[model samples]
Target chain A: MTEEPKPRRLTPKGRATRDRIIEAATELIARNGVAGTGIEDVRAAAGVSGSQLYHYFDSKQALIRAVITRQADSVLHPDQPRVTALDSFDALRAWADAAIERQRENGCRGDCTLGSLAGELSVSDEESRTDLATGFLRWKDLILDGLRAMRDRGGLRADADLDELALSLLTALQGGVLLSQTMLHVRPLEAAMNASLAYVHSFATTAGR
Target chain B: MTEEPKPRRLTPKGRATRDRIIEAATELIARNGVAGTGIEDVRAAAGVSGSQLYHYFDSKQALIRAVITRQADSVLHPDQPRVTALDSFDALRAWADAAIERQRENGCRGDCTLGSLAGELSVSDEESRTDLATGFLRWKDLILDGLRAMRDRGGLRADADLDELALSLLTALQGGVLLSQTMLHVRPLEAAMNASLAYVHSFATTAGR
Candidate 1:
């Protein structure tokens, strides 16, 4: 006879086991890649087994989506509160510096969590792609809000291309991460940030008019 | 008993088969990722069975290197003779414009042939990583040469940091492509190219001196 399914919501003990699986999955995914790391590997790393993993995730896709969603909340939302609070160029530059420093700590190998995930999976892998897309857009939205606030405060050009600048910042950040990782140095990251800061500030300065 | 290898240096037919396999594998790797793709998929796509696929490359890693090598040649050494041979601000902008056009045509979804492999594969995938690293350095060296030439000819700034500029240009291009692909649009790529072209040209102008 088919075993009855557990309740849609997990019991406390069941929840703990699921959390362990994802925790293990995160490290493995960061190193070995999402597709490269199998459920068995995740379960074993979490000190669980095949039965335990299947019970929690039901499928690999479910586990992947959960991992991405978890990363989204933890990473994309943590610094979000600061966006509204940033009203000056120094604050934005400081944020960039902090981002580069964190990436340096990671050996500049993996800055964009969503970017790493997107790299390993099919861009059309709808389940995972959606999560990555959401995370990126969320990041863009927050940064745009900060720029808009600055604009309102008369700290930015009224004609500043918010959307374009936001995208440029993202592209430069991603590019910097790649270059840093590839060269095993932070110089590229620094150069990109310096140039980007200059470019953005070029628009912010009223004297440029 | 081990069967005697039939002059396994790859006959023309075998070479053709090998090229087909590499081409198919590269496309699949770009779409599904190197980790997610398999020999079976490459063979099927190339219309060859498993044995035929194995006859050329001893392993998947070998095939990956070949693909990376191919992409390196395609990206850094396009068939059209040496537009980079000419050194002028207008020439640089024209080349940048052409590159942007290429991205626009593809909708910017495809990853850089060298870069996708580098970012997705592990650093410990030494053989392929080394192949990629060599390719990037070589391409950068070519760009560096071009910039140095421009400087010598008084087309660019005498004291311009050519290395930084070339690295930034490459990084920005990749980043711009990544953004365009994620959003399924062209505005990001256009802005990145435009800004980069402007930045580079500003440095190249005599007024900057």
Candidate 2:
């Protein structure tokens, strides 16, 4: 599932054009969904002609695939350098807080890029679904790695099922963000993250016990 | 947002025709999404002519609003007589189990009808967004009512914030189901529900403590 994205050896200028198109498609899809966003909308938004759009993407699905890849990278590594430091309970809370804060900052308008994509495309598009599943798996693994670090350092119970715990956090996040986006408030996101953090805290080696 | 659906004093036959249109729109929306499912598709699926479809639904948004109402009732009160009985932990777990079972039975294809709608329509459709928000609030209240029952029964600590707990469960459910739909598996659902349940159980007054 972690298969490398198809390589394209374009000149830097060509790469810039491709990125612009992907960026436009990402925004349009995020706002209007895959079904609502058309090839023409992306072309117009990206300021490219139809042939220019087709030059980079053979079809909307291909463009969506590129968008999925870009979203996976952005979502999983929002603060690329800090994502790996998510091992401690405080760090985890900060992560949740950061997510909630980001949502509030955006007035809870846009759902998580990957999550909304999954909601829209997962049902009808098989290839895009695979990319989304892979994105989620990568996300789960990031949380899992942090749990592993905590256990190694004796901050968590040695016997805790880290995989389940990691998945719980991710699930809470996805669910929380979706609800927040729908309700146009940050409360659901906050409540869900707090509960998942509490769940993770239950396995701590220290005071809460 | 909880405003009564528009009043239309149709005869039984007229009512049936309207219902047929709504049901067809619901299935089409559930399968292909609001933007993807056109009026033509619903008209054809319901075996109604374009004029008949238009007679019932002046516009696609009107039809979608009808679908939202129908989806809310069905999702919130799936086992209509039993939704209110969601008081005990046993009942709560049973509810989660039933949801997981249903997802498995469906091969984890269609997502929660209301959830997917929110995912697609919440960002752009203000009216539909309110309806979706109302649907989610009603769902949270059902869970909240259950937690209140548990606390009143002395099964939970008096200080436990039942509202937060209920939201946590709801969030886990949304996130879990979304992932399950995307990944085409049930583990995310199971893991999310289990963790939320465990979070709920953390407030239990006896035994584990």
Candidate number achieving the greatest DockQ relative to the actual structure: 2
Model 2 over residues A1-209: C-alpha lDDT tens digits? Answer: 34434547888988899989999988887687777789999999999999988888888878889998988887555465556678888889888988899899999985436777777777766788899999889889988988998888889998888988988898888888888999888998898888888888889997423
Q: Please give the CA lDDT of all the candidate structures.
A: 0.68, 0.82
Once model 2 is optimally superposed onto the true structure by TM-score, how far is the C-alpha of residue B122 displaced, in angstroms? 1.2
- lDDT (Cα, tens digit) per residue for candidate 2, span B27-122: 887677676788899999999999987877888888888888887777555465545667888888888988789789998886546777777777
List the candidates' TM-scores in order.
0.83, 0.91
Task: Give the 10-residue window scoring lowest on summed lDDT in candidate 1 chain A.
Answer: A1-10
lDDT accuracy of residue B127 in candidate 2: 88
Clashes of each: 0, 1
lDDT of 1 by residue, A1-209 (tens): 01223336888898888878887888887766665678888888999878888887788888887787666665445565444444567867877787678778888654436555655553546556666667667767766887788788787889889887776666676666765666667776776666666667777757422
The DockQ value obtained for model 1 is: 0.41
- Error at A86, model 1, angstroms: 5.1
